[model samples]
Target: MRRMYFIFLMLCSGLALAQPRIQLSPPQAVVDSVFFTETTTVRLELDYPGVALRYTLDGSPVGSNSSVYKGPLALSQSATVSAKAFHPDFEDSPQVSIAVRSLKYNQPLSITNATPKPAPQYTGAGLSALTDRQKGALNFAATPKAWLGWETDTLRMQLNAPEAGKVNMLVFSLLDNAGAWIMPPAVVKVYDAGEQIGQFETARPEPGGPTQYHFLEVPLKPWSSDTLEVLVLARQLPDWHDGAGRPAWIFLDEILLTQKP
Candidate 1:
């Protein structure tokens, strides 16, 4: 009887040791703005003591061996900052990330000549809305007026610079919500005086994911022009999607021009 009782006690001890470890809460990142002109500072905060915070700046996953966060990070260029919290007594916290854009925000410009205009219901603030520097929320239903959507295959716009400079990049703020049947553009082409200057082909997303925002960057060959043209081509819903073979919905909130330094 005593031997049986000892075996039972050993099993109980093993069960106790096998209990799942508590998960540590993730660290919170505080920043003044996600968009900056020259430099931006990111501060990470965690209230829990005896926990170490690790971080990465190049969009890589934050591992236990990643750089320990000692202080605020001063970023001079665009990057995705990711972080996590670790404690010896707990499982590592889920990763948290934030994207920062380094660009000359609100560069003086006039937007006009939109062909195959945005759907009337989602016209947003009209042509000027593209350059308003206002990013759209992930929930299109919540901020319907912030986005200009298109059900068609093509969208073209003319951007006129009052005091033009050499532009090296074009950033398009877009939304991707597969459940809602909204997808990002397939191709983005830029032109100057009807001559193609730059082109970008976006990668196709997998079949399922939650709604999210994406910044599509198109790199140009460092050229300047008073008048520039942008063309956006919509992707057709893939066979795996519910609306297969039909034109996918496209949403655009803001367009940013990044100048060459």
Candidate 2:
């Protein structure tokens, strides 16, 4: 009987050590918008009692020892807010992250004219759409849609800036939806006052990738000009695509001009 009691005690201890730790649910992130002009605030909430929320803004992994959540965070630049819940009774919860973009330095740009106008069905808000701050959703057909789609190989846009300022960067909000045969611009060339100043090209996208929006940032040699011209080139659909041999459609919603301080 003594030997049996010792054996029973050993089995109980083994089972206790083998038990798995429970994980709490991830915290919920509350924010008005993910894209902001100058600043925005993000708040985290978890209803479980005794549970603490921890977060990071620098894309670092959140752990039990991370900074504890005190209140909403005020952010001025682009960042990704990642948060997780922690509790002594349970393992750390899975991390949840939200990305926020800043278009704070968007200078006012006027579209004087455009060659090869967008399709009638997807004109968006017309020429003003290119400079408008509005963004397009994943669904191209969703209303009030903000996507200006072109089925041609190239698009030439005439732009005029009312204010004289030096610009260093241009951000183009483009859509890449393979299912709809819409591809991002393959190349973008910028001309300041009829002189070619900068040009950039993008690699062909992998086939069968999920539909998503992309923000392409092109850095240029800082230059100041009131009148400008932009050329966008479309990619030809690969043989693997359903619309093979044809020029893939290109969709653009907004262009943001950023000037160095």
Q: How well is each residue in 122-168 modelled by candidate 2, as lDDT tens digits?
A: 88888888777777777878844688889999899887865545567
Please provide, for model 1 over 68-135, each residue's C-alpha lDDT reduced to its tens digit, 9 standing for 90 to 100: 99999998887788899999999999887767777754466667788888888898878777777666
Clashes (backbone N, CA, C under 3 Å), per candidate, total 0, 0
Clashing pairs in 2: none
* lDDT by candidate, in order shown: 0.82, 0.81
Best by lDDT: 1
With candidate 2 superimposed using the best TM-score fit, by how many Å does residue 187's alpha carbon deviate from the native?
A: 0.4
TM-score, predicted candidate 1 vs. hidden true structure: 0.75
Please give the lDDT score at residue 157 for candidate 2.
88
Q: In terms of TM-score, which candidate is strongest?
A: 1
